[model samples]
Target: MRHRHAAAGPRRPRLPLRYLLPSVLLVVVVVMLLLRGYVHSEFLADHRVRPPAPTGTVPEKVLSGGPVLDARGETPVSHRVPDHKIVLTFDDGPDPEWTPKILDKLAQHRAHAVFFVTGTMTARYPELVRRMVEEGHEVGLHTFNHPDLSYQSSARVQRELAQSQLALAGAAGVHTSLFRPPYSSTADALDDRSWPVAREVARRGYITTFIDTDSEDWARPGVDEIVRRAMPERPGQGAVVLMHDSGGDRSQTVAALDRMLPELRAQGYEFPRLTEALGAPGPHSAVHGTDLWKARAFVAAVGVSESAMGVLVVALAVVGVLVVARFALMLLLSAVHARRVRRRRRGRGRDGRRPQVTEPVTVLVPAYNERECITATVRSLAASDHPIEVIVVDDGSTDGTADLVEALGLPGVRVLRQPNAGKAAALNNGLRHASCDLVVMMDGDTVFEPSTVRELVQPFADPDVGAVAGNAKVGNRRRLIGAWQHIEYVMGFNLDRRMYDVLRCMPTIPGAVGAFRREALWRAGGMSDDTLAEDTDVTMALHRHGWRVVYAERARAWTEAPETVKQLWSQRYRWSYGTMQAIWKHRRAVLERGPSGRFGRVGLPLVTLFTVFAPLLAPLIDVFFVYGLVFGPTLRTAAAWCGVLAVQAVCAAYAFRLDRERLTPLLTLPLQQLLYRQLMYVVLMQSWITALTGGRLRWQKLRRTGLLGSAPGALSGSGAEAREPHGLYGPGEAREPRTKSAVG
Candidate 1:
């Protein structure tokens, strides 16, 4: 539960991940799958290619039936090749290693070859592309970004072709009228579907290219096998041999090139660039400074994207590790707390000293659109055995919340109406008219048990105790969402409260039901509109101002929790974000001495880590699990995921048992993590965003279901026996304190 975007609406938390599910997330997954399929089929699959340096083939009708273009997509303006001549071409590169090495090998063999370049890669390694042009090698276009033109729109195809041309012109100060569609193996391989794209290319005055022979060196097969594959079927055959200078470790290609070029020459074969064999002009486009900078920007953008991806992976791993570590610490600390609580319980018996306080308490009920449950809340408070005064502060609810309270005409209950101020202001208004030194704050949507206030005020018997946090349970927990919330309340909040009790760092006295000494509240500056979680902010202020906060678990109240995911998100976002604000607001307290220093040093970090940072990091576990399912050791990954799940299940089960809740809802914990947990992580992220950006958060109203509806005496009372006959402290016989453990 998180929130604190302090604004008009209860500061709504951006429910980041829940917003992803059932729609936006579906689209993301579909797009990823489509992209993966396209990349795999087009580039990862084995295919034969056309001429290494050829672009689009010339259309016969336009060229008036020029001599047939060869496998390199190069139109032979004149077939001036010798009988023993061979054209060696390398497609898809200007690789730093293999390209230069191939160039060196070619230089050593006194041979030249054409290199078809992908635009992005050419832009990235412009110097290499420049070297190709300067070393008597031809350069051609192989589409920007390397998408298969067969699947691309005409506009996309045009951009791909033109971008490659621009990249070549910028990188090497030259461009060719050559073009090659991605995934091509041979000129003959261009089907009817691709011929139109080829003709479209020809319309732009570019010639297409393909390969007559393939080296298949991208697979890193043995050097000898690559050499064997590159040789033509017959000895001294005149053909275009295709190879790659990039895409993977091309050492075998280099080695094969080292071995084959000499062997081909021994067979009286002459390796020539496609231009030389076809007697075609080697075209080069003029360059400009703007084009060069544009190419530089493209390369820089690619580098940044790669760096960002690496950073994301590292950050996710760090978050996952921290979340795991935090959970382990929670288990450790919770165990220590449980042992201490048990020891204390065993030490205190019926004969132990009993807390007696007969002080008249003032209860504040803050309402907005709570008409449906306001009466029930008043009735429950009216039934408190201890002497009390009830004040209802209505924040101008159009739902007749104030009217219902006044209509009840309940003794000791008064309704005070104010303009539509926020919850914090409403609380402040309640504080203004509260007449008793002891005050209890209750949400209008909550129903307290008869003895809740009596049990709550008992902690004040210790002069040092300034506030008491009551046990808050989910009342509307019938639906799956509500049931999940129920589990969270018992398993997360209450369990943490117990540990916080032992640590004496209880930061929040939940608004649903909390007891505070009037003076303590006043000393803490009462409630402020600065934070949507005024209850939390004020409680932390009390801690820093040297006030002791305790939990009265027996003081149970049923709160009407949000029934739907949307309502839950809004409530929690405010909580998480507001909590962040409060933490930062009181950060300097850590340097102080005494109680404030203790809480600031211990409590603040604990709460921030477990409640805020840990939840934010929790998403990384899911990310890793999903990634592992797709690309890692599946069996080990599943075991590891299940291991974490089992540990959490055990913890939740222990919490539920301690809380005396049924194990039934515990079954939904895993399902809850699938969707509900992500919602929480997103809320925390939104809070951090709010904090970082210093954005205002507004109040978000949730529709009430009046789920905690009950008559004044519907639930059993803890009995008025703990009450004193005369003054609260002048008791004759007082029941000994049962247990200080948080309300389970």
Candidate 2:
């Protein structure tokens, strides 16, 4: 039986214009690529790129460039064949639009015209070539790529003609002894310089063709202008008229033909094919079957190369858009955050400290093969001003991580051990074992500031506040890459956190240091394993469940960032992929009608735009910048790129100011943009591609260096990697931190 509301199934949301536009662009790019070779050889032929020899001026005379001569230096075909008739000749096309229309007009007037098409265009539109031949129109050679023959050697000219012959044979199964050289715009344009090419055509038994009258239709002049240029002023004997069917818009040429053909016939002039008017020897041989197959295969190869170039152009455009948008949005959002920070400071008393909380809280330290910095992290947590119960949950560490914590003998500190589970699973287990109403979680590689736990837990004093996001600083910023990451964390991550706080869609509370109300965590179904970004996933779940999440700027944690590019890629790949997964998992929240809806509609979209769209587009900026440096107005392109860099610098400055960080890293901003920025976009794209392909999203852990320090400048040098701060546990004695597992 059908339910009462069965008729109304949930309607899927429409794809955004951004996605649709790119899809259309991608299709156009693909199609263009398939015709890539054709475009280059034919469309770009007239540009005179890379001629074989120097192009000197060609002058018109008795032996102008176009016509072929016999062994006795006379015309191959007598021009004055018969009076009261004209030979109509066309060149350059077989264009999709104009060629067919021209063919239709000729059929209507019961006339025949010879179409001299370049090899590239013939291969691209073979049907047009076949159709012209089937309709009683003759076909002639116009070279393969249309390079200026005057600048070519005898061999090059021969090769050009042969290729066109093969192309015509393959396309329409005919090998006529007719030829026209490129750059021979008119009979007058050919001169002594063009003799070698004409001789080469004659050597191949071809009657080199030229026109007595030019239509000038390739210029796309108006219909009247074309007719005026093409038609003879008075009736003439055996006049050969030239026109084109391609290369540009040919509407005017078609219109001119429509008017000229009828009027010419009205004056008792008959249109004859070139062979009929000028005469030609009979066919020596039909198109060879082997040559036809070779021609088709050769054209297919050209199409592939064309497609590749087109795809590249489109990709560059997309990346350019992404990069520019990222810079603009970052600047705007960071400025808003920085201004808000200043206003808040002005409103508060000096130092702007919130009242210290005295409540006891449970701290969950989840360790997984983390032996280097676990001691420092636990020590830092133990020294918090507020009373706290430390629960060290070791998720099957081979390095005896739990034993070291238990051996420390700190008061109110306990250890729990479990099989190797992921961070999310370990956290869920820890959450179950904790007894306090408020809980704080920290990564084993992270060391909290003395007052971090206190400030993080303070937000829980209000029943409405469910979780507090802490400021996560890079603890290993001594390397060039590390310094770049420090800048990113302070600017891109922290500043964005401030904005998200104001927007009430705090997407993530970093696992390094975050405080949560235990009941709220339980209400949101504890930690979920659905996304690689477990912290972000859970926080978003809380928002959907109507819990207020805010950033606690005063709460700081020094966490080790990835030190190498390989590590960084792996870490970010997981992070970005997981974030996408979480966003999708909670996608329905956009329609939940309250806080979740606001977050989905507002925060989720913003996250997608910046994280996915912006980064995806960012690389195009560099592609163009590099391209311009090589082949374009270098100074202007550089200035435009620098302008974008300036915007980024301003945003970074504001973000550093808000984080109360030094401006030293700004020195590396240019280098970072050139190198690090591209890497990040690649990581983002690779991760998203992985997600789309349904590849496994595994957890990757960065090797802990245990170099994090509490004071400023501690993360600035190679010396910081000496050892962990061990003086807190004893006097003048330091031992390598150890790890061991326990049942309870």
Best by TM-score: 2
- How well does candidate 1 score on lDDT at residue 327? 58
Displacement of the residue 278 alpha carbon in candidate 2, Å: 3.8
- lDDT scores of the candidates, listed in order: 0.72, 0.73
Q: Over the stretch 187-286, how does candidate 1's per-residue lDDT look in tens digits?
A: 5555556666776777777777666678888888899999988887777667777789989899888888889888889989888777677766766666
TM-score for each of the candidates: 0.69, 0.77
Candidate 2, 1-744: lDDT as tens digits = 000111224333433442244445435544554356344553334455332333353323433433322322444432443566767888887788889999999999899988989887887777899898888888888888888877677877777777787777777778877777765744444445675666667767776677667888888778998888777646754567889888888888888888998888887889977667656553224666677678777666555555566666676666556655655665666566556645654656343644556878999988876777777778777667788999998887777689888888999998999876667788888999998989999888887766777767766655788999998888677689989999888878887787788777888889888999999999999988778888999999999989999887767778888888887987787788888888899999878798889888988887887777777666556755765565446899899899878877987888776666778878999999889877777677666656665665445566655665342222322112222222233433344543321211
Q: 90 in model 1: Cα distance from truth in Å?
A: 3.6
Runs of candidate 2 exceeding 4 Å displacement: 1-82, 94-101, 118-136, 139-145, 152-178, 185-192, 200-207, 217-234, 247-252, 279-333, 339-358, 382-387, 406-413, 617-649, 662-693, 709-744
Residue 339 of model 1, lDDT score:
72
Off by over 4 Å in 1: 1-88, 91-112, 116-242, 246-248, 254-272, 283-305, 348-361, 385-438, 454-465, 498-504, 550-554, 564-570, 590-594, 605-654, 663-695, 711-744
Estimate the overall C-alpha local distance difference test score of candidate 1: 0.72
